[model samples]
Target: MQTSNDIRTPAEIYDELFVPALFQQWAAVVLDAAKINPSSKVLDVACGTGVLALAAAGRVGTGGKVSALDASPEMLGVARRKSVRIEWHEGVAESLPFEDNTFDAVVSQFGIMFFRDRIAALKEMMRVLRRGGSLAVAVCDSLDHSPGYSTFAKLLERLFGTPVADAFRAPFVLGNPETLLSLCNDAGIENAQVRQHSGQVRFASIASLVSTERACAWTLGGMLDDQQFEELSREAELALQPFAGENGDIAFEMPALIITAHRP
Candidate 1:
């Protein structure tokens, strides 16, 4: 599924569907962990569709500066549509565009796992942050611990192959606390603190989950053939049946780590 590395869909789907489904749960947590102030200059690294960045902008008010960066122009375009006050840049996290000590805080949610050079990105983030400024990053726990994604990946593996299944598992690769701490130490950021956090992911129905993945999950969607898709869909429905709620909503607990530290 790495072959689909550059795949992209309408960015609206991400802001509308994916954000509400998962990322919104941790948006406030990122700001709270970072302890950002109204007048602080902030940078949101890899700010896909500007959820965290927008949230930060709200906190910063007119006195503060909020800048968001992502490698994808498509994502940035969607983010730009939402707010004109927040500065949006198109760039990779490994090499930030601004000079050193530019931002009072740096935050990212579920973005670090995909960085090509994790330590380089962390170092860049630290370099941009002022002394005593905080860093807050959230990485999803392993799929084995995430019932919804784990079950979907297993179904994909059974239906097609391990490559696709492994692709589903990629986001959770850096979930371990040791990895988070190690990244900080390697980046030369001091006094790192990693916190384990659990949040409930609620979907209106299993169909909500399925439809979002089918359209926007770059690693999994548009790979299967006609017959294969039918088989996968049927199996997925069966797999989700046990998790359905009284109102047909599907809710599952997702484990994640919020790594916070300050530049010193």
Candidate 2:
């Protein structure tokens, strides 16, 4: 599974598939545990497009600072354009560019699951947090609970083949609570609480969804050439036929996990 950073031009990748509502959905989870305050210093790891970082900045107020880091230069570029106050930097989760006890809170949204070295990344997150500081992260649950993706995945597998579907499932690593908890424990984070939440992932239309997937180039990247792309698109349209309503509107349920922990 390729991490978001590993994908070429992650910033554009996000802007395409990750709609504004999706950000709001995940931000609610991240903010709930973030406990942002006027004096808090925040760090957002793998801060794609600065969604969480921007939300954190608003919560922390002008007195506080937010450092948004990502391995992809393109991602940082998008994040930079969003806000000048955010200290955007190019860095990986395994080796964050920050001092120990530097931040009052550390957060990530849909990022922890993609780290090549999950344990190392969590430890690094712990290292940067001040004593008793909180760590809040949002990750997707398994595809079973994620209706939109699950259906899309099944269709892709049946039509485009299993390999194409496998690529999409790669990034959803922490879809299980036990697996997530084990990773946290390995990183020395204890007493973590996991919460389940549901959000609506709306698509303008089936064509729009397919177009966005093509633009992101994560799941379908390299796997599909021109011919395959057209075939997959047609297959997806057929699969989505059942979901189409009178107005041609389609929405999918996106279930996510909000995992929060406090540094000892």
Candidate 3:
């Protein structure tokens, strides 16, 4: 099973390392919020490696249909290899390639913060949703809401300055409920509900936690040089000790704001 020719891309590393630790657990939560039925036509926007889409396909069974779209072809490549039943598309969130009133449920997880036009993306999600169909979106809660990451951010600042710390903090930019609700309103989405759902950020070790973020483009990828990465790793081993278990596993509460709405 081991070979010198085996080279895993960054997307593959993301799917392999990040999905199970951070994202896979949220699939059911998203599907539940969207009320995925056995025959429901579901669309997963910014589907990443298709964790949510794979789960949706399972829920829909043979009669239902599940389609996933992401901006990354590399990610879509990994997702396609995992399952052949679900439809996979490579596209941006703001301009979804689907007909209006086509989907019974639309869901996105932790992808809204990075969208070029968040309001346009939400509007597109709504536009493609049939009347009375459900939409669920999940985004990381603010850095302030997560003490572990708050500490980690400060550590990054100590080691690499504010820009690097800010890079680490980008995903939490949409953590504020008011800001997210305002986005919904701006997008003309009626009666959108935003609720904070507590979750855990776990890694095999402090090293795993730090290394994953190092490789993640969403976090600190391409920002740290080799020495800087080593410095951060050395610092993080102690800085993140509070959340580490006896087995050296890292665990902390990292809540997310889940926004749910229906097309009226």
Candidate with maximal TM-score:
3
After superposition, which runs of candidate 1 have C-alpha atoms over 4 Å from their true positions?
1-8
The digit string of per-residue lDDT tens for model 3 on 1-264 reads: 432213667688789878988888898998998999998999999999999999999999998999999999989999999999999999999999999999999999999999999999999999999999999999999999888899999999998899999999999999999999999999998699999888888889988878788888778888998789889989999899999999889888888899999998
Q: How many pairs collide in each candidate, listed in order?
A: 0, 0, 0
Better of 2 and 3 by lDDT: 3
Q: Each prediction's TM-score against the native?
A: 0.93, 0.92, 0.96
RMSD, one per candidate, in order: 3.6, 4.1, 2.4
lDDT accuracy of residue 244 in candidate 3 = 92
Query: What is residue 71's positional error in candidate 2, in angstroms?
Result: 0.5
Alpha-carbon local distance difference test for all models = 0.84, 0.80, 0.91
Select the stronger candidate by TM-score from 1 and 2: 1
lDDT tens string, model 1, 120-239? 999898999898899999999867678877888888888778986777678889878888898888988679899988887777888777666666654556666557766776888889
Model 1 error, position 248 (Å): 1.8
